[model samples]
Target: MSDKIPEGNRSARERLAQQRERDKGREKRRRTLIVSSAVVGVLALAAVVGLIAANVGKDGDDTASGPAITPSGATGEASLTLPVGASDAPSTLTIWEDFRCPVCAQFENAFRDTITELVEAGQLKVDYHLATIIDGNLGGKGSLRAANAAACAQDVGKFAPYHDVLFRNQPPEPDDAFAKNSRLIELAGEVKGLDTPEFRSCVEEGTHDSWVQKSDTAFREGGFQGTPTALLNGESIFPKKGDEQISVENLKKWVLEANKGKKPGTATPSAAPAS
Candidate 1:
């Protein structure tokens, strides 16, 4: 018998070897493709995460560029306060609030009449410190823009009425209505003599934006929990005072107690434009 294999058998062996080599090459190429795809996927995911982080940081930041243009008649620390009522009033009510906050609107609406009465009677003065907590939390510019508009109102001695109007016409928490200068100007129409060209210019230009941002930064750094932070004569009064829950009557009582034997304020604040 011959030792050599038959031609047909040899040809079959050669074909099997070629097929095995092709299979190995295919497997190697598939593995390389999978690894490349995985790397690309990871890189894309990382880019998305970085973008999200940047936007989140921007949304939460309260700092602003340019000079902090203190609004007219602003007082107290860093001139971040917008004063309402007599400067010499015996009792001072300090309020930190956000225009877009529903709770803040509720607070203002519930106590608006009482506050107005107290302010008119010279028994109490309010120092409003505006914040953009809603903008930071809910992702909108309404709080900041509305605050700037209110500061514009302050420039024209219309802050109190305009502030009331803004609260009265506040949109839902999710609605960024006040972000539009047109909406802010429209609301200003509710207040007498608040919609002048200068006022419009101020609102449109965001004249006091830097100031509002500074105020927001102060609120963040001030360690307060949230908006509508109310203090009476340097004491916390919102939601509670001592063992008493806050109510209109309780608020009045607290103010009366604090003003006991104290003279009401008589110094009238000038509404001159800030130089």
Candidate 2:
């Protein structure tokens, strides 16, 4: 009945109050810890996202790297000239090709013997304009590097045989394994004396990479579409009018007709009198 509670009762009430405060303190600490953990989780997730984005950006970079293909001034400044046949041959066959192109390989396989015959007989001059359109269209530097090595071979005067070996050892289109410098060097061994130290250095250094790049630019600017583009005296022979396809026989016929009875190795009347 007194205003103050009994001593034992007061002690029990005090203990209850202390226990309730302790429970409240524990709840507050639990909430604080949970919020801190959530914040840390969000930061970690953000860091992971940033790393993924950086990797994607690196993968998408398409900058042209490796080798500089030196433009051979043989056929103007824009072409890598592999002049087969007589210097004064009546007809000029200009070929723009990428080593990685399957059609180019087919074309080589179909007409390589004929090309060899004509080139050996000095009936025609072949100007090979190595282009890396495949690298641009399909991605990767395989075409570019292969073209560069071809140019390097040209430096040692072994371009013709080396070029043949390249086509012979060409890897399938998407598998650019053949483009590696080591493989290229191995292919060079097929051509006698092409595996010299100087030649190896050239291939490894990408000496002609710049030239390969320029050749591609020229190919684009020339407005001729696709690889293995065969031009007889500056005219396209592929993609004939209508549904007709260019055949090896027709290609020979076209060349013969273009020759107009002037045999290979003989100087044209316009250039010099036939003896």
Candidate 3:
């Protein structure tokens, strides 16, 4: 969390209230959670138009092109970046998302691994685009807190794990008390190397505001009227009916296709096992 977070934001009681609200009568818990808030499970970086250049889609596989590896050299054990891949790869991919958006979560659950496999195999790099699609709504306050906490986690190399857990047990939309700092800490505890006083302090600070705003601006200025927007290797891919799950199969298809028919550098990741 940023040092700029307002002091009134954190409260153990508030956290408990959030938890209670999440546990009982979920259906009765306003259905505001499903409201579209752009995208989910990403930490979007600000990109300037026209000058952004990427050589992505250079899959490790000989037939499929993965991401471009910048001549500037590799990221070198940079594991703590966003759930999205690091920035050193050849191409830059950006996803504009909101945490409360179910479709965004679907996209993450379906494709995060394919993207990771490629990144680990030295193929693709993804940049998360965080949008405050939840601001001003029921879960708005909580999402704001969570978003800020996410930034704090990012600072301590806990982003990806924190992100994964947040969604794994993510509560319904418009009901983000579950997404508050306390729960965020609860989620962080599930990941090794993530439980720390310093880390906790950072999360409490709400540092991701600047980062979240950048993506929010992108969503609005970038022309996204809805949540869950994705730009693969810099090319936008519309979600299937906006209700479509970004399963591993589909993510690979788009990633592979973005390479312009180039073979995947690694064995094509096993298709999304039928679920």
Shift of residue 146 alpha carbon in model 2, Å = 0.7
Candidates 1 and 2 compared by lDDT, better number: 1
Candidate with the larger TM-score of 2 and 3: 2
Error of 3 at 101 (Å): 1.6
Cα misplacement distance, residue 213 of candidate 1 (Å): 0.6
**Model 3 spans > 4 angstroms off:** 1-88, 240-247, 260-275
**C-alpha root-mean-square deviation, each candidate:** 22.3, 25.8, 21.3
Candidate 3 local lDDT, 60-128, one digit each (tens):
111112332111111222221244443444444566556665656666776677777767754566655
lDDT of the candidates, in the order given:
0.82, 0.68, 0.52
Tens digits of per-residue lDDT for model 1, 53-137: 2233235535456897888878888998889989999999999888887777777877889998899999999999998877776
Q: Estimate each model's TM-score.
A: 0.77, 0.68, 0.58
Clashes (backbone N, CA, C under 3 Å), per candidate, total: 0, 9, 38
